[model samples]
Target: MFVQEIAPLAGSLGLSALVAVLPLATVLVLLGVVRMKAHHAALLGLLVALVVAIAVYGMPIGQAISSGFQGAAFGLFPIMWIVVNALWIYRITVRTGHFDVLRRSFGKVSDDPRMQALLIAFCFGALMEALAGFGAPVAISSVMLVALGFTPVRAAVVSLVANTAPVAFGAMGTPVVTLAQVSGIPLNTVSAIVGRQTPILAVFVPLLLVIIVDGRRGVRETWQPALVCGLTFGVVQFAASNFVSAQLADIGAALAGAAALVLMPATRKPAREEVRAAVLTGVATEQLERPEDRGEVLRAYLPYLLIIVIFSIGQIPPVKKLLDAATWNFHWPGLHVAGSSGKPVSGNTFSLPFLNTGGTLVLIAGILTVLALHVSARDAVREWGATIHELRFAILTVAGVLALAYVMNLSGQTTTIGYLIAGAGAGLAFLSPLLGWFGVAVSGSDTSANALFGALQVTAAHQAGLSAELLASSNSSGGVLGKMISPQNLSIACAAAMLPGEEGTLLRKVLPWSLGLLLLMCLIVVGQSTILSGMLP
Candidate 1:
């Protein structure tokens, strides 16, 4: 078997590291600078990775190709599978006209645009993130914002920004779970550290959403409610992830935030008659015109409610054991090359827990949704087909990026890059989050980001005399910010907004927020490594 070499550029660490970054740089330049479509950029990035694996790393051509196929297969299963089913559930609601009732119900809570944004984009979006989370929150929430009369660009931006805080625990805490598994860290420790980090961001995200929605005036008017919502979310997120099951962290936080919003007294100052008249003439009229059918509203929300129930049930120890008992575990074919450490490189076996996976739970939710909504099987089939068609580009983008990541890992390119970064010593704390940001920006999933950088973060922390749990969790927390800028997520948001070629526009809108939050995460992580080291669980 061919062995992987960490420093393949004439055994030079710096040279090998530089070469290792080429695929990532190619993707960033093509998507961010050249404004290429995400699928095309991903394809080109994968090609670069393949070439580097063979030429630079001396990976066998057959092994490299097999690695790509393996990654692609994984992407299609648990990742794309969750996305497709979640969107299909959404399509069922839209087709049954129940989604309008849900929108109207939210509209009833607050007519102010800023308040509406807080409810839909921040609160409800977090709920979706908790439940489905593979671009589903951005996809569904952006469209819902538009239906509430937001401009498509604004809708996309709000959804993307709001998606950040809940992501580490999203998809029933998949990112943290992945971090625990990959880094050999205790799951609760990872969850608790992430809890500490992301909850801090949760406290500010609603305020950020208001600023994006209605500018300074929005914050000026809605600061009280925004503070209430953010604090509630942050506190509950911290408590639940630390004290309760990490798997239910986002669900608990989301419920608390939404409840806080609903229970808090309306703090919106009344507008003058003239200003109110002008607002009414615009989208406010559409908002005011929505009919409220309590039953219809309940039905509109039933799918999501059922999703929470089903997912929570699946998380129970006995149920999980039963469901996972039939898992399929096997080593991948043609990927048995050894790494520089003289161990098998990419032939680790994966266990496919078909029934217990989040994707399967989501699919079950969709089936329950069809039954509850009384949707005809024929119509359900059509909607499922449509959902798949709409996600065709996203499927390609996710698969290609995953393939690139696997090849980098198998060829030892990732190890070279990791070692170079870890050489920063104490300074690595500040750069840790950026590493995660880069990972999620490329792979488009916080779970994928954790898989890519989680172990690396732990190794770096050990070398730097820092807290491994802190840095590993930081990888996940920092990755949440990158979601707003991820090309795959951007494409999904754009598609949901029905703006096919506006990916660049959406990226430009969200880039500043992404960087700003990422910087905040860096500071938090740096503090955790030094002055705030005791804060780690």
Candidate 2:
């Protein structure tokens, strides 16, 4: 058995880390520089990861291949599954023309585009994120915005930006749960800390939404509703994440905000009697379209509802056991390499059975959508067939990114990167959020980021004489911003918006904002650690 050594690589961690970054670089270059599409970039990046895993990391070929395959399967399933089903729901809505009604429903709320953005992108999207995170917010909301008359680019950018605030608690607070597990910290303590830090973000995100939509005046004009939305979301997010289930935080906050919007009158528009008359008539006309038939819209919504139900059920303890029982776990044969630490470091693989995985549920959703739409079985088969070719590149890209991430994690390259950054000491406080950003960028989930680096942050903070809780929480809070730039995210957004070649363009637009948010989060961490010591749990 080959042993892993940390000390020998300590001196060269920086270089090794750079070597580990090659796959990511290859992906960006192929997509952004060469103008290649996501699929091609993904495949190339995957190939690069395979090489690096075997050569640079000294991983056994068999183990490396197995690791790659396992990660690819994960990428295709739950992560990609969420995206596919979400888009399918949207398509069903469009196919049935319910989206037009959905759009009109929003118009009834407010005619101002900025408010619409805040309501749809910020508030409604958060609920979607909370329910089914893996890119659900972007995939669902961006399309909703596009349908509501926002330009496709604006929809994509806005949805990406708006997705940031609730991500730490996404997938039912799975990130913090993972962090707690990895760090051996109390789950409530981890949840509370992350909760505290993230609400600061929730407060500003609604304002940011308005600012992005129509600048400072727009924000100022709508500041009341924005404040109400932000405060409600922030307060509920803080309370729910700490006191209740973390997964319910975003969903509860979002629902509250949306309810407030529905109840609150729009302050921007003066009611015109004629326009009022038209609206009243419109409502009557809409109601007359047959209440029974309109219920079909709700029926069209069932697949998504089922997805949430199934995913949630799968997460329950008893159900988790059943689901896990079907999972295939195997020791990797060849990838273990001896490191200076004298530990066996290698790849592993796990495959949950189709009946138990989120993907299986999503595929079931797709089938239900076909039946609900009354589309022929042959047409449904053809639709899925068509979906495969269209999604080929997206699938390739996500798989590649996941493989690179897995390689970095299994080969100790990620630790090398973490060590280098942590060596910055107390100055690392200002960089804590960026660490989360980098982790999320690599792993594509804030939860994954927390799992990857929560322990590292704690270790680094202790070494640097900083508060470990504050720094660890900063990782979760700050990582939310990176949600927008993650390749998995970009792929999901593009797939949802049907903007395949525009992922880079979408990335470029949101990249600056993501960094800006991270910087803000870092400052918050510094303050919480130094000036406000009692702020963290």
Name the top lDDT candidate. 1
User: Which candidate has the highest TM-score of all?
Assistant: 1
lDDT of 2 by residue, 168-226 (tens): 87755656755664455777887888888888888888888777666776666778888
Pairs with backbone N, CA or C atoms under 3 Å apart (clashes), candidate 1: none
lDDT of each: 0.82, 0.69
lDDT of 1 by residue, 1-537 (tens): 878787879889899989988987887789767879878988898899999999999889998999888777777776677768877888899899887778777766765667778888888898888876878888878877777667788888999999999999887676786677556688899999999999999989999988887778767877888999999999999998998767678888888998888777763444345433433233322455656777887899999888878877876789989998978988887777786778774245555778877778888989999999999999999999999998898789878877777777777777778777778888988988988898788768887778667766876787677777888888999999999988778889999988898988999999999999999999999998889888887
Model 2: C-alpha RMSD to truth? 5.7
lDDT of 1 at 399: 81
lDDT of 2 at 533: 68
Q: Residue 165 of candidate 1: its Cα lDDT?
A: 95
Name the TM-score of candidate 2: 0.75
Off by over 4 Å in 1: 134-136, 146-156, 172-189, 215-217, 243-247, 267-291, 337-339, 344-347, 439-459, 462-465, 486-512
